[model samples]
Target: MESLEHLTPTDREILNKSWAIVSKDMQQVAVNIFQMIFEQAPDAKLMFSFMMKDYNVTDQDTKTRIVT
Candidate 1:
């Protein structure tokens, strides 16, 4: 905790930049994971009643679910 308080401005900037890069990579990885899940187990898509469907039936939310 004490060492963190002594971090220079440059150190903070580098840490923040590194975090941003890693976060962006993680986002794409998550999307790929979801795509794989649906592809491998096509029937698993029915488990989620939240995803948007074609022009029929009831649920009308036209947005794919994304984990934040």
Candidate 2:
């Protein structure tokens, strides 16, 4: 799954369906992942300066925009 080139047709379909089901929560999931990454390496947040300023990064709305 880490390599898109290696994904089988069935694997892709499963992933597609799973994404459809989880898409609504994608923003929160992205935000949580980003938070975890930033917590592990505080400086990593600085790399995404553009992402923060254009959207309300502290909330899911920005995350949704970024993800979509």
Best by TM-score: 2
lDDT of 2: 0.73
lDDT by residue (1-68, candidate 1, tens digit) is 99989999999999999888868789787888889998898657667777526213343497544331
Runs in model 1 lying further than 4 Å from the true structure? 1-24, 52-68
Q: TM-score of each candidate?
A: 0.39, 0.51
Candidate 1 has an lDDT of 0.73
What lDDT score belongs to each candidate, Candidate 1 first?
Answer: 0.73, 0.73
- If candidate 1 were superposed on the true structure by all CA atoms, what would the RMSD be? 10.4
lDDT of 2 by residue, 1-68 (tens): 36987999998999999998879798998998999997898657557876566444344655533321
Clashes of each: 0, 0
Q: Report the poorest 10 consecutive residues by lDDT, candidate 1.
A: 51-60
